[model samples]
Target: MQIEGSVAFVTGANRGLGRAFVQALQSRGATKVYAGVRNPDRLTLSGVVPMRFDLTEPASIAAAAQHCRDVTLLINNAALGKVNVGALDTAFIDLSREMFETNFYGTVRSCQAFAPAIVGNRPSAIMNVLSDATWFARPMVSAYSATKSAAWSYTNALRVELRETDTQVVGLHVGFIDTDMARDIDAVKSSPDFVAHVALDGLARGDEEVLADEQSRLVKRTLSTEDGYYLDPPPLV
Candidate 1:
C-alpha cells in the first residue's frame, strides 16, 4: 500500500477528482502513473503518461490493460452523467441506460481487465470511487444514485472475493465535491485534493473504507441505525 515507488493507473484523469488522484499519487512518490482518459491529447501531467481509454468500450479497456500491465495500484475513477438534469425529466430516464453503462459496467469492466495485473503484483491496492448517495437516495440524480449503489455492492463483493489476494480493495464514499460535475449544485462541496489524500491515506493504513467527508460519515452511520431512515423519491415533472 505504500505509494512510494508504486506504479498506478487512474481512469478519467483528464480532470476533476481523477486529476487530484494522479497528483496525490505523484506527490506521495509514485514512480509512474498511467493517466487514462477518453482523449489523451489534452492531458498535461509532466511525469504521468497519458493513456487512452473509454471505459464503456471493451477494446479500449483491453488495450489499456495491455499497456498498463505493470500497474500495482488501480483507481477506477471514470464516470458519466446526463448532459441535463431536471424533475420527472425525460432526459434523465432516457439516459439511464447510458449512465449505467459508464458508471457501473464501465468500472466493472475496468476492474475485470486490471484485476489480473493487480494479482500478479501481490500486496497491491484498488480504490473504488463511490458516493454518499450509495447510502442514501437522492432525487434528480436518481439514475446516478442507482448506478453508484450498484458499484458499492460490487465493491463489497469484490472485497470478499479478493480477500485472499495480495490486492487490497478499498471503497471511497464521499459527499459532493467542488468538481466540474457538481459545479451547478449550490451545496457545500469538498475539494477533490482533500478527498484524494484521505482515500490514499486510508488505503495505506489498510482501512476497509474511506469516508471522505462529514456527509459520507453521517450517511454511512445511518445504515445501521435502529430508527428507519427516510429518502425522498425522484421529483416528478
Candidate 2:
C-alpha cells in the first residue's frame, strides 16, 4: 500500500480526477505510472506513460493488462457520468447500459485482468473511485448513481475476497468533484487534487473505504438512520 517506489496504472488518466490521480502518484514517488486512456495521443502528461485502454472494450483492457503487467496499484478512476438524465426517460435504458458498460462491467473486467498480477506483486493495492451517490438516490442522475452503487457493492466484495492476500482493496467515496463532469452543477465540489491525495493517504493507512469529503462522510454516517438521505433525496435536476 505504500506509494513510494510503487508501480501504478490509472484508468481515464487524460483529465479530471484520473489525471489528478496520475499526478498524485508521481508526486508521491511512484516509480512508474501508466495513464490509461482511449486515445494515447491525448495524453500530454509529462511523467507517466500513456496506455491505450478503452474500458468498454474487453480486448483493449486485456492488452493494457498484458502491457502493464508489473502494475502494483490499480486505480479504477474511469467512469461514464451522465447528468440531468431522468431514470424513466426514453433514452434511459440506452444511457444506463452505456454507463454500466464502462462504470460497472469495465471496472470489474479491469480488476479481473490485473488481479493475478497484483496478487503476484504482493503488498499492492486496488483503489476503486466511487461516490456518495452509491448511498443515496438522485432522480436527476439516477443511472449514474446506480452504476456507482453497483461499483460500491463490487468493491466491498472484492475487498472481502482479497482479505487474506497482501493486496488491499480500497473504495473511495466522495461527493461532487470539481471537474469537467460536474461543471454545470451549482454546488461546492471537492478539488480533484484534494480527493486524489485523500485516496492515496487512505491507501497508505490501509483503509478499506475512504469517505474523502464531508458530504460523503455525512451520507455514509446517515445511511442507517430512519430518515436517511435516500428516503427523501434532493431534486438534483
Please report the candidate that would top TM-score against the real structure.
2
**For residues 74-156, what per-residue lDDT tens digits would candidate 1 score against the true structure?**
99988875444544767776677888899899989999999999989878988899988777655567788878999999999
TM-score on alpha carbons, each prediction: 0.93, 0.97
Clashes of each: 1, 0
The best candidate in terms of lDDT: 2
Model 2, span 163-200: residue lDDT tens: 79988999999999999999988877999999999999
Output the TM-score of candidate 1: 0.93
Please report, in order, the local distance difference test score of every candidate based on alpha carbons.
0.86, 0.92
Model 2 misplacement above 4 A = none
